[model samples]
Target: MSVGGGGNGEILVRVENLKKWFPVAAAGLSFAAKREWVQAVDDVSFEIAKGETLGLVGESGCGKTTVGRTVARLYEPTAGKVVFDGQSIYELPAEEMRQVRRKIQMIFQDPYASLNPRMTVGDIVGEPIDINRLATGEARKNRIFELLETVGLNREHASRFPHEFSGGQRQRIGLARSLAADPSFIICDEPISALDVSIQAQVVNMLQDLQEKMGLTYLFIAHDLAMVKHISNRVAVMYLGKIVEVADGYELYAHPVHPYTTALLSAIPIPDPGVEEERRRIILEGDVPSPINPPSGCHFRTRCRLAQPVCSEKEPELVDRGAGQKVACWVT
Candidate 1:
């Protein structure tokens, strides 16, 4: 769903009816015990145009990471089709998929856990180039240095271990590693969430700069609304396991239709104290329901103020309002 605008007329990624479920055995030892499934991603659909950044935002455990992983084919989806550059990625054979992965890469949330403690930054960044056989010898070393420099790191930092670098610098190294694959589409899974607030802006600015320079498409997953608004051309709000609303960054922030969206935007603190003091905050009553057994119909109905009886009986489809805002809600 390319909401708010159709974008550059060239779609790079299209995910339709995507569903990923993980089976878990019941606690009982009996063979007759029923198995349950964790519906990580349920019928989620969206689109990303070439050179566009789509921000996916929600509270923690809303399945944002799972969606990104499934789109990248890191997780085997239980159902649905992921079409990238007009090709159905899930249908590809092993060798073809390996080749396709070169164009699709992910920057994970944790800078500390994602990198190897023992490996030097040089080895980590050059691993992708080695796997794809993109370069070797002096050429490879030069390429590594170039990548390091591209992400604000110098050639000297390449020889140091991950432990020697700060959180922001470590993230830069990870970004350089992803660039090593020469990917056109990158999934930034909360890449800045672990860093300090000051460092977050630097990373986001660097991402925007890289996107403009490289013509990159990103599925930026994060919980920071202000940062998302700054970097994303369009934004999609995810709930329990589904997308509830999508719109242009400005439109979504300015006029949110869904109750859930309104509540989310209300939580972002304003810079001006005058406006902040006058604004009304929407404090949701209950905690987020479990993904294992989300509420029937609308998953957010339980916490929604505008929810009606219909919201409990029928799940709303994401329908487009005027000016390209798409929302799934019974009452706006």
Candidate 2:
């Protein structure tokens, strides 16, 4: 998922057989270090409508974040197509790709590291506008002010450095910078993972409001099932770089089919103490397989409780099970 979220207007982003692999040198210090490829993402595909929040959820190292970055063309894909607004993003020439930056943007996971401490908030927010030559003089200043205000900050904040703000405030500054270009699509890459629990709700609510006001598209990537359910129109569950299930949020929560999806949904805490205590917990055994040499057939078979002999012989395809729900497990 792109972490890009809502216009309900049209299909704005399509990822077809997207793959990203990082070549790793051999572990030994010998002269001949055999090359190995870490399959961060393997043939992941999805589509985001103009106005929708497609949540990509999974445990750490499942390539959920990589999927978002690849969709935005931040990391050059090893193979496959990332189509945005009817254009092939990776096929575009250098000049054209640079121009496309104006239409798409990303809010990174770490606000403290993403913002430059030396530059004032104004400089940080104005960088995009300056790079794209979107504004100049007081016009630029006014634009920066407007962006800051849009994110719940003030014009006075323009003079301060990143270190002057708290974690949540820094994140707000990051959000302001993402909107500096007035992008049509934004990838919110775990934007709330670093903030306080209380602050997370504030930021999420702000994002929802901004979507309504700007008609922006978002791919929201996170492991927080509750938050994803609240913000996303659809949700995808990924395991070992492959999506195992996807569907509308309500349908997914109500009737998850894949074993991995069921385990994930089972882990979400119920609101009521009595219900939470009574609900069954599906504890998955074993660790996630190494992506460099993932298990044959279904990558999730090793950890799935419902694994069968057929699971080791063929990887199930993600097919529609009904009601817009798709699952990759044969038993489901």
Worst 10 residues of 1 by lDDT: 1-10
* Local lDDT at 188 for model 1: 98
TM-scores, all candidates, are 0.97, 0.96
Tens-digit lDDT track for model 1 on 297-328? 99999999888999999999899997778999
Error (Å) of candidate 2 at residue 134 is: 0.2
- Write down the lDDT that model 2 would get: 0.89
lDDT scores in order: 0.92, 0.89
Candidate 2 local lDDT, 93-191, one digit each (tens): 989998897888999889899999899999999999999999999999999999999999999999999999998999999999999998989999999
